[model samples]
Target: MTATTSDSTNAYSTPADDGASTASTASPAPVSPWPRRLACTLVVLVWPLIWVGGLVTTYDAGMSVPDWPGTYGYNLFLYPLSTWLLGPFDLFIEHGHRLLGAIVGFVAIGFLIAAWRGDQRRWVTVLAAGVLLAVIGQGVLGGMRVTMSARVLAMVHGCTGPLFFALCVVAACVTGRRWQRDRVLAAANHTQQGQITANPSTGLPADALRSPWMLWPTLLFGVAYLQILLGAQLRHALPTSSPSMFAHTAMTHVATGIFLWLLTWVAWSVMRGCGDLTLSRPAAALVCLVAVQLLLGMGTWIVNYGYPSILESLPGSASYRLASKNLLDAWIVTGHVATGSLILAVSTLLAVRLRRRRWVLTQLPH
Candidate 1:
């Protein structure tokens, strides 16, 4: 009897010890900050790259170098700085854009290395690899645009820049310490919803598992990308495009802009109501940015083609003349282009973060 009681106690104690060991072993390792920092740096570099690329387009300086992978028959990096600096405006912008692109590529490589080395998450590593691949592809596209002198290629290149930037932002988000902590907490919180009668976080109905609000960020992202495509089409319209076709495209673009503005406002309101700062902050920015973009769209038109005859009755409108290729015209046009990229980046971040949050929520009792 004594031996049997001792054996039973040992059996119970052994399983408890093993369970504790398992829990400790399963705990996630600490995330490294370096990967996140490097990714953020890559994201920053891409914005100026987009801006300079826009300037190249705004000034018609795409073919200034007339060579791919080289400048004036000299190696790209070996080209004389003095000539590049003191050269004509087109050469300066074109060469500078190329150099900036190369820098972004190098930073992407560093990010990939850091992620693979420090980030234990397979997805994070894959995200870093995707960023590098995108940077390479973007470089190739830009090169092809120059070698083939295809305007279509130019448009594609322009479109991909923001997409690549968006990926970098994602990489940064996933590699963040807060993201890792949230993932671990969500995993720990994992329990069958059937086991719990109600959510402790909120007293909302269990049916709120698939909330309609969860889809808004994703919808906003889609609309924003569509707007980008339409804008690119208008910006790179072929010489053969008829005035009627251009007018049609412009009207479509304007209609889409108004719809996007409304959608952004709705998204902001929903996110704010949810009280999720991560989603709401970007949503708010998207609202402000879309508003600014609409204004910039107007400024871009006024700078490029001047105000309408109807607006001529206004004091400034009557005096506003379309300055062909002036400083102000270039800045306004480039600002519009750059702002579009910014809006897309912000929307991408919000969409991804919200998606992750929703996934976590789905795993919980709610």
Candidate 2:
């Protein structure tokens, strides 16, 4: 008999070699979707939380209750629905904020437990735990803001909300099915270290394989957040400051706004050319959001500080008096606040995605 062997058979001559290939190509462990789903739900609820928080400030009702962890004489949870719904608008908003915050807190606890129990990632579990802790701290800060009537503490509390909300959004994103899928692919391909080798499976262009270019996002997030702080200071400051002092703050804010707008355009230009749809899409959204914010910024001036006094001398301008905190004022200003938070959250999410994708690409073997 003639000794004949197939080419495939000759190639894999040993079982050990085949087994090694299988082991090397194995996917990462599957992530539970439920934990991420719960996190997403928390993200949804937090939006209205920020909106209501803005309304509380819009109406200047942060001190309506004169108490913390409780509503008037009753425990927080037991506060009568009738009283909350029928009370003065400020009290209603203030009390409703507390109630909504409680709900968010409970949901966050559930999210933490789910992530800790269901997630295989130790870091994810740690992050979930941190979110829970942060929520609790937020409530305490809110309470202290009311009880101590501290404006500085109130601003701190206000700023904390956006950061926490961004965290929730990021948690949801990482726990998501797509994220898990990418993670598994990265692991199987040895792309986890963020350095893309010249491998055929990477599918990335030479430019895509470069660093994530994180500096622009960092600058955008920082500038956007600082703008928010300036806004809060302008809106919530005591009315007793000298005109020169107020003018200085106002001028600084305007200058910063101009600089921020320029930076955003530059960031948008870079993102628009990135060739990656993921980066480009969010970058487009960022551009649109900033444009809307500019118009709203103008509206904020029209509503709070009235038509520019310098412009009153112009034709067809003298008929307008500056509107105070009316319905339109509340909506415009509150939307401005909420939109700022949204921008920050978007920036954070984009930054995380870029970092993760780059890290995934890096893990592939050459």
Candidate 3:
């Protein structure tokens, strides 16, 4: 009996390999769809986690529970729902954040299991492992922040959660059917490095891959993460921060936002020029996300700090005093945070697609 195996090209062997010649047209095994599904599910769950986390910070409710891996001496999952739901506003969001984190952790486990069992790619499994570890680390960070009452921990936790979410999104993309199809193309063009030779199949100059613009996606990915860190600095600004310190952090964040917006457009332009819709679509989406995020950043400042002095010259701006603990304020600020994560996620998707462009580009018809 012959054993089935997936090669580097994603081709599979039949059970009858007993010295008999097989047909040249033998079909490959179907890639399992569960890993992508579970990974996508994880992405969906993490979005709410980010929103809840942003709320915890917005309301200064990180210390409401003041315990680790438990809620007021009760097991995390066993916490009384009545008290959690009916508690003080701060307690409700903090405990609810914990519950959501736990849910995300469980889903991460499911995603990892699906990757291990179904996805043949070793890298996908490794990424799933990293995601699981990230989820656990994020939980520990949250608990430590609560137990130690440390604002620094809270900031770190906030920054890392989005990173974990980004990883989940990448996992979803890599485990996708489209990605598997690209693997087949990559296997064929695996050795086309630095070759000016036209790809006989696509009738396109293969030298395009050698361009420096290939690094744009990578640069965009870094800028996106940096923007998230900068946002964290502002979001978790210490109570004792001086006016100048706050101004400096805000200015840096603003500058980075502008740069990130420009970089996203550059990436989109590159993708469009190549006519790779797989990359172009996400790149375009990333451009839109960055635009919305910039607007949200402006909205976040207005809601949190009221209008800038320049805005005071505009009608109705003079009357804009930031309401303390306003509902709209909370939503705007949280939406800003959530949108940053979204931008990072979309950037990750585009970056991964670009890195895999060897196969993606090969599939494009001339």
Alpha carbon lDDT of each predicted model: 0.77, 0.73, 0.76
- Error in Å for residue 207 of model 2: 3.7
Q: Candidate 1: which pairs clash? A: none
Segments of candidate 2 deviating more than 4 angstroms: 1-30, 181-206, 212-214, 238-242, 313-316
Compose the digit string of candidate 3's lDDT tens values, residues 1-366.
Answer: 333432233432111221223333455557777887888989999999899989999998888887878888899889998998887999999988888888888888888888788765566788889998998999889888878888899999989988888888888877765554334244324343322344454554543654655787778878888888988888888889898998998999999999988988887776665535576688889888889988989999998888898788989998877678688878888999999998888888877766665544443443
lDDT minimum window of 10 residues, candidate 2: 6-15
Q: Is candidate 1 or candidate 2 better by lDDT?
A: 1
Over 4 Å off, model 1: 1-22, 26-30, 181-209
What would you estimate as the lDDT of candidate 1? 0.77
> Model 2 lDDT vs. the true structure?
0.73
Ranking by TM-score: 1, 3, 2
TM-score of 3: 0.84
Candidate 2 local lDDT, 1-366, one digit each (tens) = 111222122211112222223232333344456787788988899989999999999888999999888888899989998988897999999998999899999988888888877765557778888889989999999999998999888888888999898899888877765463234234323334434333343344433434646467778888888878887778777667788877888888778777777877787666555445566677678878877887888887877777887778877677767645888889898988888888888777777766655554443454
Count clashing residue pairs in model 1: 0
